[model samples]
Target chain A: MTTGQRIDTVFTLFVRLLLAGIFAFAAYMKLRNPAAAQAFAESIQGFKLLDPLQHHHLTVLATFAVPWLEILCAAFLILGFWTRAASFAMLGAMGVFIWAISTVIERGMNLQCGCFGEFSFPCGDTIGMCHLVRNSILAAGCLYLVIRGGGRVSIDRLLISGKPKVERLGATPTPTPTPTPSATPTRPVSSRPASDDTPIALDPVRPTPLSSSPSGVDAAQPPKPRWD
Target chain B: MRFVGRVALILILATVAATVHSLYWPIYRDLPDRQARTQRAPVTDAAAQDGSPTPTGRSELPEHYISVARAYQFWEEGMPFVDARTAAERVVGTIDGAIHLETRNFIDGSATRLLEELDRAFPVIVFCGGGECDASENVAIRLSGWGFNEIYVMHEGYDAWKDAGYPTEAVGGG
Candidate 1:
């Protein structure tokens, strides 16, 4: 790999590990014990996103489900298994957080964010613009991971080593059929365009959405030779 | 599509795991039982001491939910009331002699002093926004945990008491 490509790989790896640590710690603080879980529930109650009296079941579900989701996603992130999917899950969580924080700010309620049990930083305990900004930044990171998939060092790369994106279903390993001069017909086995200068699908199963959610990435850039 | 499938699978796995965890370690394991029971009358024994609140209490007061009429009768007997509504809701008014305690206070222990100074001599009645409100029940359970002898939840809530024209004090001119 070129020096610049190696640097990019390292940076991506760093982000993945950092986010994994953050989510793991958050899950630990919340799920440590029944008392800790209750405390976290109270923190969620502080946000008042739902009425405790009316939406009791939903609130309870959130109390239980959120931490588990965090831990599971963190685990996936750490193993670099289904890394894109894990990033998507975290992105969803961050979206909820951003929405809730904004609602709290709009209501002008002074509430403990209950985000990291009792541990809050930069923005402190009180929910405010800083919290919104922090979550937004994290959301951006998750989006980046989703777009890029796991980096060179990821288990995903190790598992899918010889293939370009995914191997075409039931297709043979053969030289590309001669290119048609008049029209560029569909090449099912082809994961990338012939030229590196042009973008292509990251995976064969899903269309690379050019305009959806900060996904403006060069799709066909060959994976920099394993970042060793 | 594959990414979406993986994401859905992760969420499903997490949700199933969480459901199991919740059953194993309930978040409300420490919560004083606040089930709605119209089973018994308010106990009058002043010396009833159950020590710190536990999930299960031997006192029938935990099962005591009184009607507004009965709550008003207690009020006439000079019983102190606890208002468990949000500060904004309480501004609409509360029972004239009610002490203010909300759910958050229980979590943070900010109302520890207030709870400490309360007169345990009389049975305390707690109320909130009447129908569809569980705040009073919640706060009452906390007070019961703190060794309050006879705790009452006014099930009809504050609106019924106010609409019935009982004594109430409005705050912030609300």
Candidate 2:
């Protein structure tokens, strides 16, 4: 890989890990303490989004479900497994937050945002434009992930085709055939590590054929005499 | 959009998971019991020692709710009116003799001393902005939590009282 490509890979990994860690920690804070969930419910109640008097069931459901969803999506993002799906889920969650906060602001309601479930480290009891801006920024990060899969060095990449290490400087191998529906399922003998154990139906990356002769010599070269 | 579709799927899956977990383990098993019940009248013997507000006047409030007319009757008889509205809302106008006790004050323990000063036997008429406004209920809950036995929430609240041309007071002279 070129130096630029390597740097890009590292940056992508950093963003992915940072976002995933934030989500996972947020989820853990809510799930760890039962009182946190209650506090979270009360915070939700303050928003009056779901009236505790009328939509008690919905309020209860949201209080319990939101954190678990965060945990699920964060785990997927961290592993780079279904990264697109996880990022999309987080984006959706951020959208809900933005809407809720907007409603509060529009109505001039003083409410505490339960964005991080029960973890209210930065935001004490105030919910305002800052909370909206924070969630919008996080949503933007998720949008980036959605657009640019999991980048390089991800479980998706590993599950797809992993390029085998080159044994010699000049040696080149023939490209593997693309898996076809009509073709018989025969395991090709390969110097590259085979993904026989992976049950997922995904295509591996194929090597491009070189124009030079396969005999480790140019077709234009003349035979050379050597004393044996 | 694909993103919207994906979010829908996540919400569905999360809802299912949460529901199953709740059904099996029950999340709110530890929440304080909210069911309302009339407590056997407070023991007078302990009230003498702790300086607790002695239950006097009426034995106990017949019901948790009282109509505006009933509240007015209580008002005429000098019952304390607790305004559950925010300070900003209170600036406009309020029932005469209403004491401002916001939900925030209750949560922060600022209202504790004030509540302690009130007589527990006298029915405290709590009212807010009325019509779908839940402040009155929330404040009433806190009053009950603070050991106030005879609590009455005015169903019509301040707005209705003002509309009816009842005696009202404002922050600044009008």
| DockQ for each model | 0.31, 0.25
Docking class of 2: acceptable
Error of model 1, residue A153, in angstroms: 1.1
- On DockQ, the leading prediction is 1
User: Residue B104 error for model 1, in Å?
Assistant: 11
Candidate 1 docks with a DockQ of 0.31
CA lDDT scores, all candidates in order: 0.69, 0.65
Mind giving the per-residue lDDT tens digits that candidate 1 earns over A97-155? 99988988998876667677656777775678989998898899899888877787788
Candidate 1 Cα misplacement greater than 4 A, ranges: A162-228, B28-44, B47-174
**Backbone collisions counted per model:** 1, 0
- How well is each residue in B1-174 modelled by candidate 1, as lDDT tens digits? 887889899889888887888776644421233322322233454423632222234355434666788788878988888888877677688888788887667655687989888787667888888755556765665675566757777878889999999998876433
- How does model 1 do on interface RMSD, in angstroms? 3.7
- Candidate 1, A62: how far from true, in Å? 0.5
Fnat by candidate, in order: 0.61, 0.39
